[model samples]
Target: MRIGLAPEVSAALRTDPGMLREVNEDAALAEYPSYLVADGMGGHEAGDEASRAAIEAFASVIRPGEVSTVRDVGIALEAAREAVGRVAANRVRGAGCTLTGAVLVQHEDQVCWLVLNVGDSRVYLHRGAELHQVTIDHSLRDEMIAGGAHLDALPGRNVITRALGSADTTADSWLLPVEDGSRLLICSDGLTTEVEDQELRAALTMGGQPEAVVEELVQRANEAGGHDNITVVVVDVLSGGAAWHVGVDSASGSLAESANEEDLTITATVPRRAR
Candidate 1:
C-alpha cells in the first residue's frame, strides 16, 4: 500500500557523554517523519555498539514513501533487536538498549504519529502549553505500580524490564492523530532521570526554535549533574508545508541535508559518542 506524503517537518538532535561517563552509549536520529533515541546498556564499548546497531536498523527501514503500517514498523524494530542480539552474543551478558521514537504515518488519509517504545526511553507530545507523555516505560517499577504496588515500596526503580536484545523484545506501539503546530520529543532516560516533567514541559513550551529547545533540554540535563549520556530529538510540524532539514552527527563527520517543502530522504551514519 502506498502511504501519503508526510507532513512538512523539521527536527534537531543533540547528544552528550555527560559529566560522569567517558563514552556515550547513546544514539539518535532526526530524519523527518522518523526520530528515535536509543540508550545502551552493558559496559564500555559494548553498549555503544548495541545502541548504534539498533539505530542503524531503524534507519535502514525509515525511508520516505516506505513504512506504511504498524507491521512495517514492527519489522524494523525486530531487525534492530536482532542486530543488538548479534552484538550481545559476542559480549558479556546484558548487552542491550532502550528504543523509543515516533514515525509519521498516514492512516485512512489522515496523518498520524506512530510512537514505539521498549524500556525507559520515552516519546512526549507538546500541544499548545501542555506536555503529554505518549509512551509508557517498560520498567520493573512501572509494572509494579501498575499492579497496585505503592511507589514508595518499589525497588530497582531504574531497572528496565524490556529492551532491544532482551528475551522479550516486542515494542509497544501507539497511533495518534497528528495536530498542527504540535511538537514531539523523543529522548533517552538521561534527560527524564535528571529533569522533572514540569521542567520538561516548561522547556518544551518556552521554545524559540526546535534546535534551541533541544539545546536547552540537553543543557538542563547536564546542569542537573549529567549523570548519564543524554540524547534528545525534537520534531515540529508546520501547517503550511514548511522547509525540512535533517542533520546527522557521526564519528566520521556531521552532515546536514535539506528539502524545500517536500519529503526528506535521510541517509547517514548514526552518531556514537566519542570514546
Candidate 2:
C-alpha cells in the first residue's frame, strides 16, 4: 500500500457513491486485524443502514490495533448477522448486505489471515501480474457458474443466494499464512463489474501506493459507468518485509514482527473450519 513502512500504516481504504447513485450504500474498515467491505442492498436508507450496522459490529468486538482471536471474529460475525437481521426485520422490502474481508487472527499459536466471505463482495490476492480471487461468491449467477453453466447462460449477476439478514448467516472462510509483500484487495461489486480484472491486474502490478491504486480503480469504474456504490481497501501484508511467514519463523522476528502488531497475535488454525 502507499502508506509508509511505519508498520501501523498497513492499509488504505476508500469508498464512493459512483456517478449514477445518489447515496453510497457501501461501508469499509481498515482497522488492524480486520479489513472488510460491505455492499448494502435494498433501498438507499435500508441498504446504507444495513452496511453500517454490519461494520459497527466488528468495531465493537475487535479492538483497534490489537491482534484478534477466532472467537473474537466469530462473535463479531454473529453480532453483524443479528444487526443486519434487525435492519431487514423493519424494512418492508427486507434489507440485506454482502460482506467480505480478511481478519488477522491467532490460530494454533501462529499468525494467520482468516479470509471470510458472504454474498458477492470479494477478497482478492493480488500478486505481481495476477489477481487471484480468494472468496467464493454466494450469488445466483456464481452458483450457476459453479454448477458448470456458462457465464453467458446465467441470469442477472446481482441475485445473491446468501447474505446477512437472511436465513443462513454462515460465512465461508479459509486460513492463509502471511506472505511478505503480499497485497490483498477487499472490494464491493462496484469495482469488479465496472473494471475488468485485466485492468485491475495492471494497476495492482504497477508499483504505486495503495491510495493511488484505489483512486485509479474507482476512477476506472466511474468511467466505465458506475452502476452501484463502490468501496475498496488495499491491505499489505508486510511493509518492510523479509520473507515474512506467519508461523514458526515469526518468533525469530522474520515474518511476525513485520506487522509489528503486538496487541493480539494469531494462533494456528488448521483444517479451515471457523464457525
Candidate 3:
C-alpha cells in the first residue's frame, strides 16, 4: 500500500498556526499505514500546544517499519489517552485536546483502516466515485441533527461534545476496510466546516495526486471563509498489495510522555459508524 500526506495553513495567516501532526508509531514488514489530525484546545497558542503534545505522545510509541495489528492499534490509542491524561493530571487546569486518527492494518485479502477520534475531526472514504464520511461528529451539530435540527439551520455552529484531553479515561475509535485504489481522508473541523463532503468528493474524485487534492481542499476552505485553522491528511491505497500481518500484545507502557495541563481556550471550531 502507498500513502501520502498534506498540511496547509490559513491563506491570511503566514504560518499554519494550527497544531497538527501525523506519525507511524511502530509496525513491521510494511510501512505504518496511519494518519492523524489533532485540533488544539487553547485559543491561538494554547490549543496548538495541546494538539502537539498529544500527537507527540501518540507518535513516540509505534515507530515506522514495525508490524501492527488491530489489537496493536487499540493498545497504541490507549497509550495516547493515558499520555493526555498524564498531561492534565500534572497541571491544575483542565488542559486537553481533540485527537482524530486512523491506522491501516492489513486484513485477509483487504486492509482494515482503524479510525479513532475524540472530537469533530473527520475521516472520509472516496471509493467508486462516492465520497462517504466514515466518522460522525461529536459536536452540538450532531446532537441537533439527532434531535431534529435541519442540516440547513446549523450554520457556523461550533461546539465540540467530546475531546481527548477533556477527560483522562476514554476516547472513541472505529475500524474500516479499504480496497485497492481507495482513498482515505482524515481532517480537522476547519476543512469540513468550510467545504462540505460533496465538494470534497468532487475534488478528490477529479483524479489527481494527493497534493492536488490537498490544494483544492485548502482553496475551497479559503474561498468559503478560512475562519479557523485548516488541516488535511490524505491516504491512497494502491494495487499489488496483500493483507497485513499483525500480532497481539498487551497495552502496558506502550506509550509514555509528560506535559503540564492548562485550560486552552477553544476560540475555534470543534462524532459514529455502521456495522
lDDT of each: 0.74, 0.75, 0.57
Worst 10 residues of 2 by lDDT: 248-257
- The weakest ten consecutive residues by lDDT in model 1 span 250-259
**Candidate 1 structure lDDT:** 0.74
Q: Report how far off residue 73 is in candidate 3 (Å).
A: 1.9
Provide the TM-score for each candidate, comma-separated.
0.82, 0.83, 0.70
Candidate 3 residues lying further than 4 Å off, grouped into runs, are: 1-15, 18-31, 42-45, 89-93, 106-110, 149-156, 240-275
Supply the TM-score for candidate 2.
Answer: 0.83
lDDT of 2 by residue, 1-275 (tens): 12222233378898999998898889998988789999997453489989999999867888778667666777777778889988888988888888889987665555667777888988877655556777777888978887899766999878888888776656776666566677888899999988877787788889488888888888989999998899999987654333543332122111232222221222232321111
Candidate RMSDs in Å, in order, are 10.8, 7.5, 10.1
**Model 1 misses residue 40 by how many Å?**
0.1
Ordered from best to worst lDDT, the candidate numbers read: 2, 1, 3
Best model per TM-score: 2
- Better-scoring candidate (TM-score), 2 or 3: 2
- How far residue 247's Cα lies from its native spot in candidate 1, in Å, is 33
Candidate 2 yields a Cα-based lDDT of 0.75
lDDT, candidate 1, residue 34?
Answer: 77
